[model samples]
Target: MKIRPKVTARALAVLGLGALVLSQAACASPTEPGAATTASAAGGFDYTDARGDTVTLDTVPHNIVMSEQAAAALIPYGIRPVGIWGSSTPDMSGVLAGLDVSGIESLGVSYGDVDVDKLASLEPDLVITGWYAGGYLGGLGAEDAEVSKQIEQVAPLITVSAQKSASASLDDWRGLAQTLGADVDSGTIADEKSTYDDAVSQLKSALAARPGTTAYAVAPSTQFYVAIPGEFAELIDYAEWGLDVRESPIARDSTSGSFSPVSWENAGDYTSDLLLYDTRAWTTPLAQVERDHPTVATLNAVARGHVVDWTTDATFNYASYTKQIALLTDAVKALPASE
Candidate 1:
């Protein structure tokens, strides 16, 4: 869509969060943006986010359709939108409480089928989507045409494609917010970054933190997979910061690089100091998994109380990542000081 040149300039006029506006020269030959800017282009938005092909909104958006789990990340920063996909889980409820949108028209149906008719009815100013493929694509299956048609009709569609890549972690969600023309608070992002760096440092400081201390993660799943925390989980590993440590590379059912299903009969095969678990699987309510195996109640983590629920409310899966990191840091801090 064509944004009025004047409105575009005015939008760039918002005070300062380091949003980069394209000079006529810069716009002519697109180049990779260095970082979330130090001076914002419009409305002090956080990043330039204008790709070779741009989706520029002339002003701070008033009514928006949030169609991905990443929607979880935006609502907290006061982008309280007109419509959002709802969630059924409760552990994630902490993250969802901040949204002030109560009575606006439901802007669009979530990841599942992309109901074109319902989306068009909401009449949103713009639609922001992420991970339609991994999150909702399974259930929707081969109906790509239907999905495309429904999405196109709602508003200008911007695809974040987060699901396509296994990222370092949730920070990727910030990139999406920048693209949406909302410059999220830098202080908030900086605070989160600082907290995260500190947590990792503390974990490294505690002598008990080590690679061999044993660690693994799992989703509250049906056909479960083993979750191996990558460089991301290293925050819990004490080393450069100093504390002896050694964690074996995670070993799971099929070498699939995901959390695995463990039974008490052979659960010992997978032992560790920490067990990270989540239930973000789009299908299969984690509640169902918890109910199906009361036996898991006997696992050492559950029995001794190391087991922690990753999320209660589904909506917060991607919404409150900073808070999520802070919570994760606190949870790790609470672990018994073994060294």
Candidate 2:
């Protein structure tokens, strides 16, 4: 066989060029051996937040913000965040005490008041914010241009939304944890997840001990609201967490409010085994709920002392969906066992 030096040289040159291209691509891609990727990408973390927004973060975040669904997701990490979002009352205060964030509460911020300054000051490389950004984000330009820029500057943000429908946020909390924690909190994150998993397992056993019982939760803000588990309803999957969480016609009006608003006139129509209240508001005024559509007696939960002060234990964005399952589990257990 005759050897051709010219042809051999061309082949070697082409091979060299291919190597350069591959190296360049590796540099350009977000998914590096130690770097994070998207949900669809290998070692990816594709997540949808409360705002119906989809976002991807490489390798999990270490200094997570413990955004909207803190207890639902981050508390399990045992990271004891420097900051978190909360409601305007004791529910949040009490819930915080149970987790590692006890000292950082003031470091705590609210949904609409995310302390963009605080977040920026922390200068954290990564954050675990929610999809809603608690309305802190989006709808920029004109009036909100300044705050909008401020948020983008608060470090790269990842959005998370939990919903009842397929279009709702993805149940990627564990995946997100696994992804973000891979950086530094891997072992701690795993332990945190195990703790959460164990808590859930215990909750299941507790639930299994009893026969099925219908349950419902209400958050009394300025008005009355209900918490319904959608696609991200981890509580709905509990071992003993029973419920008939059907979407009410009122919910058809997304504008009215979520979890369903209870007017005094219509409170009787929605009674079940129990009714949970945000109580953070009522805790002070101590005013009895005036669900006047029917006398309070008309509602079975009210009749059975099932009406409860539900502040701690639930977790949602801004307590938005704080629908804290562990809190709910404990609360439901506190209920009088129905014979």
Candidate 3:
């Protein structure tokens, strides 16, 4: 499951404090072998996941079960899982776009809906998913402790954190994919990395040219949800790349402390030269949003047509990020400098 960066009240309430404490205390050192270890080692598969847990196996896992988001990251490197589960159908998942998943078994499509029996039937050697803040597992609800326990019983469960910056998360995936026996340094992977680097350079140049073009990333629902740039991997990358992405004061006062949800009537309170509008499936479409929340139309960014579609669920991979960065660069080029 691809988890959103935005933390809702319900999500906050379910966070496992004990898990969070364990994760902090057991945080592995940066130079740990498991972080950069390869599966080719004579001792067999040994890798440390985001939670800092070192999962050691007698042999490299050939049959794996992964969250669709994880599959998206690994598939590009030629690491295919035996089974996958997601928060949406494969066709509907933005992260799973342009990938071939015909041969993989579908464990489930909705959050917390994993078919444990089917997953076990596949005889998966490893179950890989994303680890999120609050100790939440991707595709599994925070409250679904029983399901998590059951999945753990079937196979060793591991994760890469979704809480890291896009680049950091991608690096983690690269290491994990290498541990899973992917040739990450050659052929298609190398070419993709070069392309991604070029895209990053282009985006930086674009932002440099468009000095002072402030942006506000947001999702429209019954409320106008302002994204906290620090909480989102892609948004953090954009900010670091020199875009003046605005921060929401509401996040400071929010119970979830991840995003600020303003009433539609107060949507005009936050404004920027450019608007990074969330276009995830869960958000209300921009056109419908404008019609329903007329106040949103009053924002200067909206009036000037300076809105850019932001894919919140983009995969943590060079290929996916190369496209995202290109789109943002184009948007930056089109945006006018702030007054």
* Per-residue lDDT of model 2, residues 54-130, tens digit only: 34444344554545344434555444455565543223554444444445534333434555556555544345544
Task: Give the C-alpha miss distance for residue 157 in model 3, angstroms.
Answer: 1.0
lDDT of 3 by residue, 197-297 (tens): 99999998888877777899988775788888878889888888898889777644544345787777778888888899987777899889888888889
The clash tally of candidate 1 reads 38
In order of TM-score, best first, we have 3, 1, 2
Better of 1 and 2 by lDDT: 2
Candidate 3's TM-score? 0.86
Instruction: Residues 1-339, candidate 1: write the lDDT tens digits.
Output: 121121222221222233323322122223232123332346532222222223444444555766434355566444655555544221233335555556644433333544455555555555554433223322222325576544443455443433322222245455555555556556555565466556545544443343334445555444544443332232322223342223334355553433445443444444445555564544345346446765554555555556444542332323343344445445455566554
Q: Which stretches of candidate 3 lie over 4 Å from their true place?
A: 1-34, 38-43, 251-257, 337-339
Q: After superposing candidate 2 on the true structure, give the runs of residues whose Cα lies further than 4 Å from its correct spot.
A: 1-72, 75-95, 102-108, 132-148, 164-171, 182-212, 220-242, 251-255, 282-287, 290-294, 307-339
Native-structure RMSD, model 2: 12.1
TM-score of 1: 0.58
Model 3: worst 10 consecutive residues (lDDT sum): 1-10
